[model samples]
Target: MSMTLALRRSIQTTPEQTATVFHGRRQSFCRFGDRVARLASALRTQGMGSGDRVGMLGVNSDRWLEVMMGVWWGGGVLNPVNTRWSGPEIVYSLDDSDTGILLVDDHFLHQVEGIRTTARRPPLLIHVGEQAVPEGMLSLEALMAASAPMDDAHRAGSDLACILYTGGTTGFPKGVMHSHGTLWAIGIQRLAQTPMPGGSVALHVAPLFHMGGMGRALVQFIAGETHVLLSSFDAREVMQTIERERVSDLLLVPTMLQALITHPEFDCFDLSSLRRMVYGTSPIAEAVLERALDLLPHVAFTHSYGLTELGSATTNPPHNHGAQGRASGLSRSAGRANAGLAVKVVNGDGVELPRGEVGELVVAGPNLMLGYWNKPQETAQALRGGWLYTGDGAHMDGDGYVFIVDRLKDMIVSGGENVYSAEVENVIARHPGVMSCAVIGVPHPQWGEAVHAVVVRKPGAALEAPDLHAHCKAFIAGYKCPKSIEFREALPLSAAGKVLKRELRAPHWAGQSRQVG
Candidate 1:
């Protein structure tokens, strides 16, 4: 179940299928597979081996897919660098992963141009952009052109496929090691659940480095569907692409959905080609989701739940949100485990608690990543008894729906009381003046950690702390209300659209061993 085999199969099954569309060029599956094979052979000549890590930092493009497939075909591991990170932050991941070959698009070349002074510099550079390789970097086009296409390595099981770096407790990103078996299983399962026959166009508007975008693209690719690539999300461009390409499926975050639904020209666009609207990464405020549902009546909404540790689209059963009895279960739940995945909610002592008890959700399944790369201790702690202990606190109801309460760390401990930040954030988002908000734990001399909120207001709205406090007080307990508030033009967000509460709470924990709970 190597991704290489999947690519080869797509080419054989439907050679003429549009494998990728980026910057107005469409490449067929057969041509895409041949490029991948030649690139793999070229990378092999350049010293990438079975488990060697190859770092990629680039804007999304056809080349990203080509190089990623090339890495796998070369029997190497991919280490996808986050597009939004400081130079030191980027360097830290390269050092931690010991990546030898660093690939970069032109937009990010300036970031690594002077990284050689560091002890952990990548040995080689592959330029993945249009313009000529700037002076010293190896030309990506030349490498593929010089090499001959190679055959399958035939690794159809749990071999390390890619290392996706995600933010960790160490205050830097941890590399998540996903296997070929796991990645392929999740992709095939998604295609089985939502069959994308040959002509179906899958839009990759989400960043490819993240799990959701990667999963969505793979699912469509395995079925020989057209790939509509978007470098970065633009709400207007998303709708325009749908109309132009006759896109069938789109993976979106709640933030993107809000922007699209509220776009002034949304009503004017021909969006009927869209059949599925899958959302996750973060919870959507109820009103925003409801409004989106009302606006796009023809599309089926599938709420996905999973992180990089467990591949995205973990649980996406077809559901009708308006159905009276089903709505109560599905709306508040993150659906049941998708095929090849198993989920359980466990207590602090690691005992599997009975249904309806709010415990830390743990997943034991094929979709779970192999482990955290280069962090054996952290990996062992996370992968206990074959289950990945997701920090997310959740409870499974009788019908097996997972209700995510909050992250065990994000659950506020205030004066001996447990307050979930997601609970407070949900309430704060209800305020008309609030465009977005993140609840974080701050220094409290008496209570240990006090609830603090950073808010981004709606454009042209007059908002005051007192008014916001009163608003939250109406919906949730006063203890969970923000004791301090900071107004920002925009909140810090990860590629997946998750609010970085850790970054927001950094100042408060400067001199102490920070407690997440």
Candidate 2:
């Protein structure tokens, strides 16, 4: 019913058990619960009332978990800002959600001034970093130390818990709202499908801001498992942590898995403790999957498929990655729908398509998001007739396995991040170089898909790739910037005068098995 219930249960049953490990700092369940309560008390003292919004801008750390639970405990909704975004993007999300109290770490101190100057209503700043607190910001450590521990607010069942921002087709990010009930339902569904082992130690390398990372963390908490935190993903650091902490579970994108398996000293680490590995965000290459299976024969692999709006919809179980499943071509599919969830491929007219027919994937489940915050029309478009119309081109076989063939939305998944082509194109169009552009994803060896832009320059103006790249970096995140740019006199267009993105992406993905990465 409520996420905080998990914390209370752990405190009652296993108060002495280790709950969190980060950079040599470990906290038991009892200590963690007390800190969370204190932080919640501090938030309440800072004018955060029930249903108020609080934003956090930081990487993965023990404090991140505390802030998340503390907000819920204090009856506030969480808005976890994307660290990779530029100042304007972050400001848009915070301002859109009307977040009043913003948490910052040392890594993002430089952006505080810009946020204060640009945000419609500047928020109160709280420092949650290891470094010394900034002059004007309140220190989280000081607040927790000074405030008295408070009781949980007991907000549960349809109470708004989080507003997660996802890349939007309208050249901005949209806040996807998820209630406590929806999130709790998804966690239970995942557990029912693949139960975690007792005394499991989960390693957190994925960014906590994204759904994939946050959902996995929530499941670990629901199961009362220990967590090993990492500030960010570094190949060597991840391997070292796995060996040192004896990590039993992990979630990764195919790109991270590739980097881990191909590390020069990968075999030197004693990764025998690792028992389960769940990968998603993008399909894995056949070669990469085979290599990982050969190297970690003891590990069970699962591929999870879902969106921000619909939390874990389907999961390709461990057996599907084995020899028999591979021979049957099941390894290439995204697996069946999760328990209590319904999935089907529907045509453009909202009619369900027959099996083996590629169409847009639609899902109906309790895990579906409440709606996009403050955007009624968009929400209506996404959720209609009791099904969330996922903009993914896929098909279901007779056995109910879903195989994603392409993306119906003009979005690209690169290195586990969603990059909307419209967002990138908007930034490029602002350049004085005066041009029209189309952005698409190209086949990439490591990133799975790389952002590629095709542009037609103004007749008299001379714009180069380097200049455009620098221009884009000034306005958008580095990962969304084009990895390659092509200049042309004219771009291929359709009868409707829309630029043909499929034509732009065709040559690059000539022989790939799937159009999507």
Model 2 lDDT per residue over 1-517, tens place:
9999999999999999999999999999999999999999999999899999999999899999999999999999999999999999999999999999999988899999999899999999999988989888999999988999999999999999999999999898999999999989988988877788798999999999999899998899899989899999988899899999999999998999999999999988899999999999875788999999899999999889989897788889999999999999898889899999999999999999999999999999999999999989889999999999889999999989999999999888999999999999999999888479999998888888889999889888889999999999988899999999999999899999999888888898898877343
TM-score of each: 0.80, 0.99
Cα lDDT of model 1 by residue, 1-517, tens digit: 7777778888788888788998698999899999999988988889888788898889788889998888888889888887765566577778888888888898988875655555276558888888878877898889989999987666558888888877565434678888988888879877766665556888887788877778887787667678888898898999999999888899887668878998999988899999888877764556667888789878888777777888753564556466653566466467777777788899998999999998988888777888888889989989999899988888888988788766665655554344567667877888999999888877565455679999999999999999998887765456667999989999889999988877887788787533221
Instruction: For candidate 2, list the clashing residue pairs, or say none.
Output: none
Best by TM-score: 2
Best model per lDDT: 2
Scored by lDDT, model 2 comes in at 0.92
**Candidate 1 segments whose C-alpha is farther than 4 A from its true place:** 313-316, 325-329, 410-517
Q: Model 1 clash pairs?
A: 1-156
RMSD (Cα, Å) of model 2: 1.0
